[model samples]
Target: MGALTIKNVCKSYGPTDVLKGVNIDIQAGEFLILVGPSGCGKSTLLNMIAGLDGITSGEIQIDGRVVNNLPPKDRDIAMVFQSYALYPNMDIRRNISFGLEIRKVPKSEQDRIVNEVSSMLQIDQLLDRKPSQLSGGQRQRVAMGRALARKPALYLFDEPLSNLDAKLRVDMRTEIKMLHQRLKTTIVYVTHDQIEAMTLADKIAVMKGGIVQQFGSPRQLYDEPANMFVAGFMGSPSMNFIPCKVVSMGNETGVEIDGGAGTFKLPVRSNQLKSSEGQEVMLGIRPEKVTHKIESHLENSDFHLAKCRVSINEPTGPDTNIFIHMNGAKVVCRSTPDSAKDPGEEMEMMFDLSKMVFFDPKTEERLA
Candidate 1:
């Protein structure tokens, strides 16, 4: 059975519409992630799912039963918020077992569950210590442990790792992945971090302006983005967008790029280009897809070679980023650190057009 379903769910606060017809269907044991910039209604959708917020319209079903009117406690869901709300005076053991205690679990069973959870989270020795003594990461673990202790029908996490340091966040991310693998629990996580969304989610929902923009696996979002916003939002350094005019070159479609050496035509392999001819379009390509000319030929691929004077070069250990002018716009090319030339030097570079993406400049929609 599908674990959860949200059908045309919408939310409004008086005149402001917070969510606009959100829909999702997740299978059992799937790790679903809702990610977007702040105020995009990712949290609002999660709150509604957990019954922390009421839905304005539409139906929500948990295991085939409509749950729009169900209270949070009756929804069989547990949420871990951004803030680790650990009890200040209580020790870690008590904090983790507090929910079970309130449910009138026996003393022996509570102790057994607490010990098992602490061991799983690797906080066995710190059970006796109070929340004040634990580090940010440790405290986050305790908060997670509290939820894990219950084994609820669904786990809802709202930026649970956003409070920790960079290094610790990375560690906790891996640990959470391991935990999910072992437990096989159905989870719906919310975050604004693209890397977290990419690495942790079995499926991802990208939201913007209170609406779902795209929903798919990480590789699908990266390689075949639904629109220009998703194409620009999913990767680091972002995909480069250069404005050019679409033109016909024999049987194939091409783009005219005027990069100082004079205007040149570049072939584009898209059947959707018939209507785009003579129209302004945005050429989207990742920095890594733009590499040194030598490397392109070495890989047995023909490169669309262009010559331009380098404006800047940023060497970061493994690779060097060379910035230059292309079609009157600044473009970045990724090359080996050892092969970097100085700024102002004219160098030949290749655009791996095989991975190139085209967008309608006016609509901001992907053309191919």
Candidate 2:
């Protein structure tokens, strides 16, 4: 089984710390994604896990055994790199079976394994073609087939789809997910794309400045982000962070929002509302919640109506993004293309109070 554990793992090169006290655990068959912006040490962590680099302080455990001293070949793991590291001179069949040949497996067995993996990846027809002759996507499948031929306990994908085109990346993302489901294998993927991390991972570790910002199930990280960076990193169009003052008027405690036309009090559910009263805080809301007024929001007490003057509209086929200014900061609202208001027009929107998340503006930490 491919249960992996990184316990307070720290990596330093001379005086520069690349990974700082990183800790994570995942059971067999779980897909864990390391996601963040560039230079966040995500790829460095992946290399450490693969034994390609040494750990400065802490241990990495694979299947309950410490692997600090184990060589990459001795470890029961396979990796697919971003470059699709295939041999230029070798055909796809040999490229996939080369690992087995290096292990000195019988030629017949190697051929059988290569056939099985190639057929599974839908690359059977390309077996006779050299890696140089194939397209990026095809070469990627050969690389995956090469890894699948090994049947290792764990799989490491270091931005494997990063080199492909946008459409091919999406296609390969689905294929990788399907491959994982069918094999029930453990996977640790590294990527800077939040969309890939959200769609492909069961658990996500958001990294920044050589430290883990947050690590949890995708929903947990999406719904209850640990900090402002996580809130801004995980979702598309990102979460809107409105600078607002927490105010308490009578029994009502909420954040005051200036949505261009006028100011309104919207209730924000938070345990720290009392302590944060009169303090400036960041109110986080996804674009979907601040949509054009809907009938369903009428039954909810947490939903309030507010008018915002549209700055612009970005139509993305299914849903249009309505841009508007709130307290001098631009915020986006998700609405249907047909229902979206024209630019410079005023529109009524339902601001869902229940879904908003509060954060400390100074520290960027969640305020409850």
Candidate 3:
């Protein structure tokens, strides 16, 4: 089994702590991503798992075996770094087989492993080329090939795609996903890109200020974020936050939003809203949730139409982002390109309140 468990992990340099009581567990073959902005201690935590850095406190287990004090070489793990740490002078074949050579693996076995890895990574034709002769993407594949040759219990990738261009990065992401499916090896990957985390991870741990803010399946974090920070950070356009006062309209609880054209009351039913009557709260809604009116949604009791003056319209191929002022804050609404209006034009927009989320204005925590 390739399962991994980290318990109460902490890291410190002198008096300053880098990781503070972080914990995570993953079953064999699970793809876990450590994602956050720079200096969030994701790489630091990854290093500790790989035995590259000494842990200040906590236990790391691999397949139920404690590896806290073990050295990297003894941990039965392989790492791929962002810099593509390939030997400049060594040919691809030598680079892929070097680890096996040191492990005293038989020459015949080493040759077989090299051939298999090179073929798996689709780099067999470039085996004779040196690191300098390969492109950025090619070199990355070679790096992965070297790790695959080891057949380790765990694979650690530290922002491995950060060095490649946008197109190559996307292409490589697909390749890596396919590799994980075929190998079924436990992987702990660190990346600051939220898109990568959403696309590649079976589970994601979002970190900030050396603490994990949230950890779950990507859809869980996207659909039900722990707080405003997570809701805003995980999406491309980011969820829109509008500060409004909660009020009661008939038997339904709702919030009032004042667009430039008129005031609209959107009925909402959430635990937070029940107790927050007449109190100010942040209403959270994703851009796609706020769109042009659809006939089917008109029958929903929580659906309402409002008129707003478009402040800006940005066409993004398949859809257009319409910016409008609501509750004195700029809010983005995604609409079909054909239905989008020009700037300063008054347009009718639909607000779907069924999926709206509420957060405490002071604590910034999800209230529902």
Candidate 4:
């Protein structure tokens, strides 16, 4: 395990700049995830860190050693690829031991390492089989086992769980988490899946358009997102954004919401909104915060009640997605299955204004 540092890293191809001033510091044994949509430079950054791609500028250090010009062999890193990348002609044992063989490790040590890794990953039974003989999940485990055998200073996972089926993905995710916990190794995992980033990483760098939008814990990026993009991209089901005009309500202020039936002001407690009075700002709230009104909601000073006609009701076992309109924009309210009503029915929803976030309409940056 090793500490990793990327300082003012920038990458470009001829005229196109790919990574712009990317900076991330991961302490030893910390799991760091680089996450974003495709073409966001996450994979490119991972490749750069692995020394597979050259650094256009800036520095990358592993264990305080600058590896800007080093080859992959000299980096002391093991990488598990998205495609499994196992040698089809070789058995699982041979595939996992290939690196050890290349490094001229003794046969006894190689066998011991392979055996230990395969056992930990529960792929001991498949060690004699070829890549084609194993299923996708098994192949992924073999790939992880191959990386584990190396015992490198850093482990790089390049969307390693993306190829598995949904159930298998979840299972493998848990397996990987357990592996990290048991080993406490320094890891840099790259995935476009926010769910993976949220569940696995000690720290996350949310990237977009060659820029690091935000770098923090999952909860920090989820609850106190730096901008609208970070707020909208980090959460599952996305945060509901309603454009509302801030207005003065006696001594305090609130944002005006048009909830189909009628317009009402949802009380907002913020000193930041004082300067934003009468201006349009995007109010962001999570679906879970807007749910079926209950007595608990009535007791909170930050909660406000409103009735809206349900446009759609989507059931997902334990919770139902109650779709409604606020300020002419489609909004989703997650409700318990027992209280979920049918479409065309009017339901009272309690808005948890305490958790509401306001963004500047023009800049798309958080205001309050």
Runs of candidate 4 with Cα error greater than 4 angstroms are none
Scored against the true structure, residue 93 in model 2 reaches a CA lDDT of 89
Model 3: CA > 4 A from native? none
Cα misplacement distance, residue 229 of candidate 1 (Å):
1.1
lDDT of each: 0.88, 0.91, 0.92, 0.92
Cα TM-score per model? 0.95, 0.97, 0.97, 0.97
| Candidate scoring better on lDDT of 1 and 2 | 2
Give per-residue CA lDDT, model 3, range 1-368, as digits (tens).
33899999999999999999998999999999999989999999999999999999999999889999999999999999999999998999999999999999999999999999998889999999999999999999999999999999899999999999999999999999999998899999999999999999999999988899999999999999999988988989999999999999888788999878888888886655786789999999999989988888898877778898899999999999999999889999999998898998889999887779999989999987
Worst 10 residues of 4 by lDDT: 258-267
Q: Tens-digit lDDT track for model 4 on 200-268?
A: 999999999999999999989988888999988987899999999999999888899877767888888
Per-residue lDDT for 285 in model 1?
88
- Give the local distance difference test score of model 4: 0.92
Candidate 4 lDDT score at position 270: 76
Backbone clashes per model, in order? 0, 0, 0, 0
Q: lDDT per residue, candidate 2, 199-315, as tens digits? A: 999999999999999999999999999999999999999999899999986776888988877888887676668766888988899999899988877898888888888999999
lDDT of 1 by residue, 58-133 (tens): 9998877789999988888888989988999999999989989987899999999999999999999999999999
The pairs that clash in candidate 4 are none
Task: Give candidates' CA RMSD values in order.
Answer: 1.7, 1.3, 1.3, 1.5
lDDT of 3: 0.92
